[model samples]
Structure formats: structure tokens, C-alpha cells
Target chain A: MSEVQLTSDLIQWKDGAADWEEAIRVSAAPLLQQGNIAESYIDAMVENIRTLGPYILIAPNVALPHARPEMGVSEAGIALTVFNEDVAFPAGHDNKTQTARIFICLAAVDSDSHLSLLQGISQWIDNSELLNRLLEASSKDEVKDLINQYS
Target chain B: MKILCVCGMGFGSSLMLKMTADKVIKKKGLKATVEATDIGTAGSTPVDLILTNNEFASQLKGGKSEVRAVVNVASEEEVEKAINDFLESQ
Candidate 1:
């Protein structure tokens, strides 16, 4: 799938919420509202952060938070976010070190699709230049444009 | 062939790896079934191979099937490479 197929307007972030939970909540809230995910799914994902720390902080500026599809997923897509300010996952070794400005929460039907999407995402995250550009993105249009370039 | 991919929660990363595997396998014209299992249910799945990331691969119980640890938690290339490496060795 192309970047357009993977993202939507819901993934954009406007405010820089100080609390990491709030940042995640803001990023994923829209998808939840549109019935893309069960309400509990959002809670489960946020709880992972609270409990496991920022283990999903896979790279320098990006964080991917997701739960099982069984939690709630009717479709296959990705929710994107750009945090206005850095937010920290306290307990991680990268604790306070890896603050994500870009968040991509994936929702898929099963393991196979989830894996493919994550792999697509990994290809984007693995690129140092693209990641930096994602962080620097000031608007949703810019973010989408950047992702379009890569995806 | 049946492939079982496991992770800590069988939720996020594990599922992602499974998707990539299925895609690659399908692309290569291999008929296979792939599922993601958490470490909790790894014993229940009937799979010929196990694909997992860094820390999670180490947790599997000794069994008759083969196991591979893909380099990154989420790299299709790594997963493909691992599978190719396994196939070559076999």
C-alpha cells in the first residue's frame, strides 16, 4: 500500500501535550472515534506505555503503540501523529531519552497484516533522513507529503 | 507450510512480523500459513517454523520445529533473509 492508503487526517497532531499519555491519546483518539478501534483498545495501548515503559520507542524520534487486533480493529490502516513537544516514557532505559514527535499506531486484522504494515513502517523509520523530516513536519499536509515521498 | 510468529503479547510487533512473512512467502509463490502467538501460547500452535524478534525468540520451548530470530523487531528484509538463510542451511 502507498502512504495515502496507510494514513488519514485523523493522525495529525496539533498540540504538544506535555504528558505522554495525553499525546498518545490525542494521536489515537480520532481513529477510536471513527470506530476503527474499540475504546478498550486505546486504553490497552496506553496501558502498555504505562506498564512496559517506552519499549515501543523503536527509534530516536518515533514511537509505535499498538495492541492486539482482537482488542478492536475492524479494518487495516495506520494512525499517524506528530507530537508538538517531546514526551517521555518514564521507566524505559531510553527513559526520558527517546521522546517521540511522530507516532504511528497500527490497526490490522491479524498477525500477517500487522507484520506487513510494521515492516512498511520499519522501512520508513529506519531511514535517518526521513525520520528527521517527519519530526520537523509542522503541519499534517507536510507530514503526509513527507510520507508520500517515502511510501 | 505453517509458520508461527511469537512475541511477548502476541499483539504489536509479533503480528507485524507475521504480516511481512506472509507477504514475502506469497510473493515467492510459497503456500504457507502464518500466525502470531504470544509467548504465553507458543506451545499450542502447530507450526513448522517460528519467526520472532530479538528478545522474544530466546523464550521458545525446545521443540522439533526450526526457529529464526529476525534482525530488527520489524524488518521484512531481515525476515526474508533469515528464512532464506534457513532454507539454504536445510
Candidate 2:
């Protein structure tokens, strides 16, 4: 299977977001514009969190927001949005707070296509240095370069 | 052993956790099969163990297989430790 590339058009570097829901919407905006996903997909993502809790905060500083393809996915795509400030999600079952500054919204048509994409994303999330660079990146090109370098 | 990695959507977080768990299982030389599925399907599927985050883990309470709650699904270190601890207990 071919791996999906993180194009510059899908990367957004901004000061921050108002809340987790807005963060997901802002991150998913690129995918919406690219026609890979519809607006309902974004709502589904937020609703999934509401129903299932903040399990999307997969790591210390990264959140992978996604919903079922049947929700409203047109094509398989990934969007990255970095925030200068932290966005908090609901407390976990243990009552521990979870926060993230980087939101990566995933729009997958099926389970098969997302494996390679998750592999690439896991590489970045595992690397502290690379993740730091990505969080601090100022431009889309810089973010794309980092993704290419690590992915 | 059959291990199921579960998340709300099945396509996103669970898949990521499965990938990380696969690496940890292989590196640790554990003899277990890992699969990813949605929370809804996970309840019906028969598996030896279930790996998921805290929220989903709670939903699986009183289920057939043992449920493991991973604090950080994205961290290989955390995943490796959780799998290893479970395997050692078995």
C-alpha cells in the first residue's frame, strides 16, 4: 500500500484555539477545503469525544481526532494544526487531565488506508525532538518538511 | 493469544494503538495476535485480551477477555510496558 503524504496545504500553524471543539474544527478546515471530508465529519469528531471521552489525546501534546468513515468522509486525508497554547479535553476515567497543542485530524475511507498513515504519525509522536520542531514550526513549508523528514 | 485493540471509531485511535502494540509484542518476543476494532464490535468479538484507553476500557468492564487501559496510546514506551506487564503475569 502506498503511504499518504502530508502536503503543505494540509498544515496549519496558528497562535492557538479557543477550545478542543474549535481546535478540531480548525484542524479539519484544511480537509474540508480539500473536499476530503464534509463538515459533518468535523461534528462527528467532536461528538465522538463527547460520547467516548478524550481518548483522542493519544499522547502528551498530540491529539488525533477522527470519526467513522460513514459519518461523512469523501476521501482519505490527514490535516495537521499546531497551536501555540494548550487545548484541554475532558478528564480521563482516572480523573487525570489531558491536553494537546497539536491536532491531527484523520479522514480515512477505510481501516486499511489508515495503517500507513498512523505509522507515519506514530513516528512523529514518538520523537520528542521532531515533535518539538513541528510544534514550533512557523510556516506550512516547515511543517511539511518536518513531516517528510520523519514520515 | 488474540488481542483486540479498541477505540470509539475503530479507524483512528485503535489502529494507532494496534500498531504500537504490534511493535512492542514483536520486540518483546511475545506470542500473541493483535487486532483493531471499534467498541461496538469489540464486545461481540472473542479475544484473549483487550487493549484500549481508559474510557473505552471502562466500557469493557465485566467482559470476557481481560482489559488493559493504556495511559498514553501514542507512546511506545507505555504500550511496551503495558503489554510486557500483562504477558509476564500470564
Candidate 3:
């Protein structure tokens, strides 16, 4: 798997965002700018979460956001980000919810490669310290540092 | 036997979990065919056991399975234990 660096527009959010919607807006900017994913990808995934709470909390504090590729993924790629403060996805399995400080947005060209990337990313999220670093990173360089360390 | 790994957007952790399942099962000398799919396509196929990270499970509306378990797939021990436990139960 190859690593993609987060650029300026990608790191759109600061330390605070009132809700998940706003957060997704900022988080989706970079990938959308790169033409990796269609504009609708973010809205679709965010809508799923808004309706389902944190159903996709794959690991402890990290949540990987996604929607159907048909929703509009023109390319096979991912845009990642670390959130400063913990954000909640309200309802989820077990009363157990997620802080969701890290976001891995996946856009794939086909089903098979999509699954491959998903597996790679899940393994990546398993690392607690790595997840922490993603959440704590201040700039794209720092995000790149964390990605290099793990990916 | 068949094992299905699921994930969101049909990508991400589920694919990772599929690789993990392959490695662990191979090491354990178990005979099984592992297939990973996005949850949206889950109903389109047949599976014996379903493995997935959190998000994909939610999208799995209803499908065929003797067992359906949702684990982080992030924890090796957890994955191993779940696999062992499933094997024994079967």
C-alpha cells in the first residue's frame, strides 16, 4: 500500500468543530479538491453516521468513515486526518461509542482494491499510539510523519 | 468452509481483517476459503462466518450465516480467540 500525504486544504479543521457535519466538511475538502472522490462521498458517509450514530467505530477512538463507492469515488485513494479533541458519534453498539479523533476517508476505483486498502487501514488503526499521534498531529507534516511511522 | 470479511464502502479494515484471517488460519492449519466484501454486497453472496470492523456490520441488513461476529480486527489476540472459539463451537 502507498501513503498519501495530507496537504493544506486537507487539514481544514482546527481544534474545535461544533458537530460531526462541520468536521466532515473540513475533513472532506482536501480529498474533494484532489478529485479523488466525488463531492457527494462525504455527505453520504456523514449522513450514514448521522442516522446510525457511531456504527462504524472500527477501533477504540478512531472511526473510518465511508459510503457506497456508487455514491461517487472516481479514484482509488484515501484522505486521513487526526482530530485534536474527541468527537462523539452518539449511538453505537454496546452503549460503547467512539471519540473518533481520527478519520480515514477511503475512495476506491474498484471493489477488490477497496477491500485491500480497508484491511491495511484497519491494521494501521490497531496501533494505539499511532492513533494517538494522528489525533494529536498539528500539521500535514506531522500527519505525514505518523503515516510514515506506521504505513 | 467459508469466511466473509466485511467493511464500510467495501474497503478499509474489512480487507485488513481478511488478510489477518488468511494468515492466522494458514498458521493454524485450518481449511477455509476467505472472502472479503463491502457490507453493501454482503447479501449478494453466501458465507459461513462473517467478520468485520464496526461500520460494515451495521450495514449488513440481513444475510446467511451460522455465525456473525463483529470484532475490531485490530487486535490479534481477539481475532485469534474469536477464530479459535468459532472453530470449537462449530
Candidate 4:
């Protein structure tokens, strides 16, 4: 299996955003600074949610927001931001919403580049104990440790 | 069997689901080909099964292929069970 590393610089901790769009923008900001993605990628991510709803909510309290590689990706990278308060994303056709505290923004250069990272994330999400630890992680090192241990 | 795993944009959650589904298929010793695509193009793709979240699955109801709504895309157990159940029915 291919391995992907999670660096501390790509992780952020914030009180919370007023809404999911803001949350996604905040999460993708680090990647933008690193030149891994362009501003359009961020807009594409939010646009995806607006049109398709929050299918990005892979699990309760966890969301992986991303758009197509051709949208605006400069390279393959991943960034994560954890909010102290929950943010809501559109849920179903009836206008319901799902709450998420952890947002992992992904920027892949191609369809297959992020598969390994996605697999690692899937394993982490399936482990409730680890998921709770991630939600409670206060420091970047704490979050990095958890990701290293699991991913 | 051919399976298409879908999400809003096809790069994130659906890719994750594809990984999980691939693992399940291998562990179960099932012969299947799985691919990931966005919701916009998922309907046009010809596949035997479509695996996605409940919201998208609902929209795919009455389609040609079987649609399986995975409650937790990251849970290998849930993905495995859904695929196994679908296979058993066939």
C-alpha cells in the first residue's frame, strides 16, 4: 500500500466558522499557501457541497471536502482543520444538515494520487476511539501523533 | 461484477469508499471491478452496482443498476456487509 504523510503545518485548530463554506475555506487555506492548490479549488469544493449536498460527510463529525483534480490542483496534498464547535453541511434532499467538527481538505493532482490517503482516513474514521481522540486533539502535535499512529 | 463508488466530487469520499470496497472485495475473494466517479457522471456510467451515501442512493432509486446506500463510507464493516448482502441476493 502507498503511504501518505500528514505534516503539522497542514493542521489547524479554530473555534469554528459561521457555516460550512467558511469552514471549508479555512481548511483549504493552508494548502493554498503552500501552492498545492489554487483559490478556484476552494471555490469548487464549496460549490460541490452547494450542488450535491454534504455527501462529503464520510462519517459523523468528519468531512473530507474536495473537488476534481482539474478544477485547480497544483499538486497532491491534504490539509486538516478541527473546529471547537460544530459546523453544519447540507444533509439530505429535505434540507436537513449534518454536523462536522473535523474538516480534511484534499487536493489531488489526479484521480489515483489520493487513494492511499483516503484509505488511511477510512481506517481512522472506522476506529471510534481514535476518532474521538482526533476530535479532542488540542495541539498540532497531538493531532499528528494520532494520525501517525492510525494512518 | 462492476461497481461504481460515487460522491459529490468523486475525488474525496468516493475514492475513500472505493478503497474500502476494494479491500472488502479482496478479503471476500469476490471477483469485481470497482471504480470511483462523481455523482454528475455516475448515472451515465454502466455498472452492475453503485455504492454511495444514503442521500445520493435515494436519488438513484429505480436505476438500472442496484444502488447500495452506505451509512458510514469509512466503516469497512458496513461497506463489507452491504456488498456481501448485495452479492448474496444475486
Ranking by TM-score: 4, 2, 3, 1
Model 1 C-alpha lDDT per residue in residues B1-90, reported as the tens digit of each score: 788887657766666677678777977787888887676787666678888743345445366667887644455567788778767877
For model 1 the local lDDT of residue B25 reads: 91
DockQ of each: 0.16, 0.64, 0.43, 0.67
lDDT tens digits, residue span B42-82, model 3: 76787777787554454553556644455566676666776
Where is the poorest 10-residue window by lDDT in model 2 chain B?
A: B80-89
Report the lDDT of model 3 for residue B53.
56
Clashing pairs in 1: A92-A95, A112-B19, A114-B16, A115-B15, A115-B16, A115-B17, A116-B20
Query: After superposition, which runs of candidate 2 have C-alpha atoms over 4 Å from their true positions?
Result: A138-141
- Which consecutive 10 residues in model 1 chain A have the weakest lDDT in total? A89-98
- By lDDT, highest first, what's the ranking? 4, 2, 1, 3
User: Which 10-residue span in candidate 1 chain B carries the lowest summed lDDT?
Assistant: B53-62
Clashing residue pairs, backbone N/CA/C < 3 A, model 4: none
Query: In model 1, where do residues sit more than 4 Å from their true spots?
Result: A93-97, B1-8, B15-90
Q: Determine the backbone clash count of candidate 2.
A: 0
Compose the digit string of candidate 4's lDDT tens values, residues B24-90: 9999898999998888899988788999987799888678889898867878898988898788889
Candidate 1, residues A59-139, lDDT tens digits: the string is: 456777777677778876778888767876564432234566778877777755555666677677657788788887888
TM-score (all chains, Cα) for each model: 0.66, 0.89, 0.79, 0.90
How much is the TM-score of the A chain of model 4?
0.91
C-alpha root-mean-square deviation, candidate 4: 2.1
lDDT of each: 0.70, 0.84, 0.68, 0.84
Q: Of the candidates shown, which would achieve the greatest DockQ relative to the real structure?
A: 4
